[model samples]
Target: MKTPVKSLISGLAPVLVLAIAALALPAAQAQTAAPAASAAPAGAKKIIRYAFRIAETSFDPAQITDLYSRTVAAGIYDAPYEWSFLAKPMQMRPATAAALPEISDDFKTFTIRIKPGIYFADDPAFKGQKRELTAEDYVYSLKRHYDPRWKSGNLYILENAKILGLSELRKKLIAEKKPFDYDTPVEGLKALDRYTFQIKLAEPAPRFISSNFTDGSFTGALAREVVEFYGDKIGEHPVGTGPYRLAQWKRSSRIVLARNPNFREVYYNETAPEGNARLQAIATKLKGQRLPMVDEVHISIIEENQPRWLAFLNEEHDLMEEMPADFAGSVIPNNQLAPIYAKRGMQMVRYPRADVAVSYFGMENPVVGGYEPHKVALRRAISLAVDVDREIRLVRRGQAIPSQGPIAPETSAYNPKLKTVMSDYSLAQAKALLDLHGYVDKNGDGWRDQPDGSPLVLQYATQPDQQSRQLIEQWNRNMKAINIKIEFSAAKWPENLKSSRAGKLMMWGVGWSGGPDSDTFLALGYGPNKGQANHARFDLPAFNKLYEQQRGMPDGPERFAVMADAARLMVAYMPYKVHVHRIFTDIAQPWVVGYHRNIFVRDFWKYVDVDLEAFSRSKGAAQ
Candidate 1:
């Protein structure tokens, strides 16, 4: 599935760092000579400052696997392979329909034909020598992910015993005590030539095209020479073939990115027709048509909420993703902020699914390592014990919808015919099921237990958030009715994610992206993914068969039938109890241009032509 863009910078109260380039330009020349100040010569370029959320954790794509790293990494790196986001959501069905038709075709094995003339970013530490990106770069990148020394979080994404030899390679590397080789020859990845790359999957993956677009998950082409010389500072000053290079990072304060003069042109063509009014207005902004409309994107890191909103309103930051709802509704409406809003605007976006925000509840299946007993009826009762509807209304203010299966309703993969395990707030039924499963409190200590007087308690870990706390409280209250108590502990994202992966967690909130394709998010059923708790360690042979079948079937009646069966089986088993899929929300000032109204906000910065000169003048007048 597609990874959501992480790190939305707050626009509240940002302390502006005057760009060196901006400060150097004469004030009068900037205001009166807009063309001179804003325009880029045939070869020269202009820079646009954008507000990015997280500064970034790791520059190394292999080691970095989160929202914060993925979005920024995209610019720095180039993929010989890339996915095309279709205009229609949920159109990426298996067999019958591939991803975008323009993407590489499968010829026994998938191979991507690269567009020529592309080059990687120069290694600043290496005398700024530019290296041509080649198919070998992809091989090196994948090897980095599988390298044990690198310990990349995404190692499992492309594991191949035949190609990567992860099991054998790691074994030998441990014995030899050598640095993980980036060029470890594996059958899964091969360079047809300098420009063509062939990626071999263990099996034909219907969602491979969409999966390639995700950051951190898929391997990106890297310059070998760059990695060799600057192996130590690679994460600090990463090099790639992105539109913008990391110029400066002022940790938790600001990051400045300059235009990559040698960067490739716009990746995708999203041009609207000339007759379209939106296109006409957008076209007029480009007085001097350059491919990438924005020149310099300056990201300021403001963690405090109030300041971020204030900055956006005052026109300090162009755009702010993850804007607080209260600020989005109340502040931007002010006429005093009219001019700031005049230049740019905000957009509402959601994935294929609506209302459903997926929340993961740990299931005790021991295959991966779950210790919980295998009781199908007990799992059903647990689902019956928790009222997802009430939780949605109370905890989420009815902002979300109750979901029973992994596939969100908005996705075409969702099977509506499946029977939902709706908990009707019936504590008696839950107690009856527990009794039927032979669990009761013989000593009457205000808690249920095994026949041998063992206490039945579920210890759940959750993030330190008000919403999570409230959900735990609700679950605790309902569990009391069945004389069962659950212990709640608050942990950070890393710990929760780690424990969940180990299948040691009892319950936690998990958000997954359900892209246009069904198989994209089907990793839940993969054998290796089991026991890493993953909320549910369900090893249903039937579900696995259906999942594998759905991947090969075309997008039609038969595919839908199999997908529906899978969804029904998942809901019936109650492997993971879900509540909602936390959608990404953002608010931007009107002057912050090029914001899209779609779920996938790719190329949002391409057409935006912000009037930074106006903001400069406003600041000058205020001073």
Candidate 2:
């Protein structure tokens, strides 16, 4: 729960972000300022209400890859291992405070130390008073990612050629050998002791610590019984040792959680020194305090935009994740939402984190049934016609970075020296390209025409969300001024992704996201990966060659060069028209505390120290 040193934003900056100290305010101060409760149950547990736009697609970690479910699941399970956010890159201070296993200087053979006294979610089928988590349980969980039957999209974490025998284990799973035994043995992982584990990688990786233990989106330990019964169902029925437990998942309605007393007490000081030294510090700072300042978290499904904003205003919800950038001026200026505006709140945190802003150009290839063979030049011309900087200033309202290529800003692979493919919006240049491609407005109907005299019109599909709709509408206007008629179609988020990947889309809204590693970004441009989900399906041999080489190289200046080469190819081609990477912000009610937005700290409530008494009163009045 401890905040780390602040990070500075790179690319187009001298911007210095500051690490914010916790706000100095007593719970009583905020509680007393609120309206009187309607009718109070004398000692009801505190309930924190939250709002999310999309219902979790599923709860199984193997399937549920979005931000929503991961945040919720962080609470319900306990891993044999945990990470400390306060530690620097490549180092994860243990949750149990046990001696760290010795790792080689090159990071080839990691000797990990496990902390004792951790337990998984209690289940009747496990046949135990309490299921204690052991090092063996972690071995089972890590191996599960590679199981062919599971087909975890995240298996890429271990899919690299460097993972010895993983390919063989995957083949065995397909043949139904139950590749790794949860009860007996795990093939690639081993338990050296009751509280110690070891993993053998085919090669040294400098970012292993960031890739596995500390990062929230990556692997963590799992309970054997929990995985057996739940199996693939673990996504929805996540059972973890975090601060909260799954109470209800009402499908498209809402997901609920109840605080775990066992975790609250244990994780209270897990980040600090252990034994008497930790106990003394905990007591002195908290004044004989216990764990878990709050009792429950209730996530209300708000698929619509208006409801989400109003719910936060009326205090019906305690938190708002990823506030709409267009509404920032209106929402952040309000006194009730000031907590999000403070230095502590606005400070951007990146984890192997890269900028979220990038553009997806629909690179049409005649070989793949793309735009008409004659329109290839037109597609490339349209890509260059976009004015990304203006798009950021106008559509984004100055909250994002104007992107120039497929690669996100400030990432390890981002190439600063690439020849700018999208510079200066020149209408003359656009007109010349159109003329060369045999486009002309012969009748002067304010619309371009093909050689055979058909109108040059294309449809751009996008999500129906308010922000997206607005951006698309504006983009239509931008293209129209140039006599290129564009039809904007709105579709559901999931369906839109499907349509884009299937190449049913000519052009649409697209964004790039991934961890710090270059491979994460490579998936979008790699020829094979591109054919699958990358909407543009840009098949560049040079780009694919570099992406493969960058993955195995240890983190260093050389790897940077390799990744930069891949990025340069993306910029030069202009596959998708560049846009801006807007900063994502989460807003919450005054009483909702102890939540860190760190991607590594999956469960905000684990560190959550909320005002329970006030939360209970709020919920009672809402009912």
Candidate 3:
């Protein structure tokens, strides 16, 4: 579940009625539906099985925004740069590029040269010809986001970078109501030659390369022919030059990926960070092994918590990506793996996720949205009424820390020492604020009315799930204490997301995961990023100025100062009531080798291997 920090997408799973049906089925019966784990014959294929709590939206790099879809796209597409899998301090390494990008002294220009001989996965779009990846492919890929036809959710990220002429070209085409001219040359983004491309920014951007180009899922190169061939259906038919290819897709149920026979020869040679014994051991064991050690990767979308947990426990899946908070006390008691599972050779990796769960108020909505004093007071009063500490203890099961502002953890701009009223919970203050703003019980009704004596019912959008229900119950209690009327509109995650981006939903609570760049979280409040990364549509000029001021300055105390001021503006406006930064616990079975969660890296499947012998033994022991 990738959130809107990068593109305003939600990282939480959307519960479906199908999940309820799965819950009714027994664990053994559910396991029977999945691929069997029996011992394979000689020269058989090795498979690594896992389950996502949410379903993927699309495979195309330009269109998809969710975490599950990006996870699949990361394995299939090759970006110029990628995060080092085993690095502790988080370093960037060349993926398809020949070397690190050559940056100008001003940090306004970046030149990258891609390695030759890399070819796309064989597809009919190429007319049975070998489609070699070139510098032009990246140029065209970046241009795709600007095209009005695609309505890309990630357009704001590139637009914020202010590439020299690319934004101008897009604006010209959009103004003329003409088709995007892909062949038109742009000064900012250009293919220098056969293998080299350069990007010139309007202003200095020290972290642009690492922030935008490092993740293949966000800026992966796409072949022009494939995009033209698929057209409207391009998202369903993704063709790329990577370690794996999509073998099967069952809509929201299952997805299968097989090793790409045409993939380049990539070997496991990651450097382990010093003093980290676990990574050193993994590096030593996997060195020299061919990339994507597994022959096939099987993924299932299990939206319900118990069924997804049961799938991992029943060995239907090899890894449980995120441990459900409902079972945290029993599974990983006191932040340690339970003895019962530890004795079985299960591995647990616990870390605080770089994300924030936020409930945003659409600034354009009539009921809860406005910049005026009274409207601002209404939102702030509501924020103060909600108890974040209670939500963390009861709903989150103590697996989260209250967030003070928009900045996520593990970022250059993040200051743990900084505190504000973003997480304050006080019913008395909330009531007084509302009373001061003229919101009172009019017509003798129990609920508080608007200052104009109209109904002040809050329409909140939410998904149907056990966790969501618990969170909503907390909202009900909080609103009741404040004498405010609130109503929930239940819908699927995807539907709610569509409504959210369209600004149709008055309020929706979702989590946003931070990307490699620290500026991503703050983009949620940027004025120009409205309806994209800025789901709240918070258009405050004071905050926007601070955001732009920090973008040019190199990461330092000065830039941090600007970012802190921007975060303060976000808090003062109360467009988004940021709740908590969650702590995640992922568990892997004994047979899964090189299993480690990298916060900055999305494509970890290539570095992991499955121990077939150990898997077979585990099955035998179970019998």
Which one wins by TM-score: 2 or 3? 3
Stretches off by above 4 angstroms in model 2 are 1-43, 78-91, 96-102, 172-187, 192-194, 264-291, 333-354, 358-380, 406-419, 422-424, 437-459, 499-506, 516-519, 531-536, 594-596, 612-623
Question: lDDT at 483 for candidate 3?
Answer: 91
Model 3 ranges off by over 4 Å = 5-40
Task: Name the weakest run of 10 consecutive residues (lDDT summed) in model 2.
Answer: 1-10
TM-score of each: 0.77, 0.76, 0.93
Kindly list the per-residue Cα lDDT of model 3 for residues 527-620, writing each as its tens digit. 9988787889999989999899899888889888888889999999999999998888889988899998997777678889988877876675
The local distance difference test score of each candidate is 0.54, 0.57, 0.85
- How many clashes in each candidate? 39, 17, 5
Please give, for residues 1-623, the per-residue lDDT of candidate 2 as tens digits: 10001111111111111111112222223445656655536576667677767656655555444556655655664543455533223235555326645767766777667666766666654776776667776666677776665656556556553555665666765678665543444444688888777777776666665455553334555676776777666666676656667778787688888876456245354343345453344334544235455677788877765566556645666776665445544445422344534422322221223544444655663321244534555755665566666666655545666555556543556654554655447667777878887788977897888767777776776665656665666667667756787777877766766566566666666555554455555566676654343557777888878876776578788988787777667655656565555555676554564444544455656455556555566544444
Winner on lDDT (1 vs 2): 2
Candidate 1: residue 457 Cα off by (Å): 1.8
lDDT by residue for model 1 (1-623), tens:
13322222223222232232133234333444344333223543334444544345676787664455555665556554343323333222221112232333432256565556667666565476656666677667767776776666655555511233545676687789976664566566777787666666555555555444343224556676777777767776777776667788776567666666777655333444546565445545553555456666677755445566556545566665655433332333321222223323333332233223344445553211232443555556666787776765555434444565667555556655544664344667777888876778877787777645567776767655444556677878767767776788887555666676677766655555534555545555545555421346666778878877776555778887787777677666666665554433455543454444444323345446555554444445334
Give RMSD (Å) of candidate 1 vs. truth.
7.3
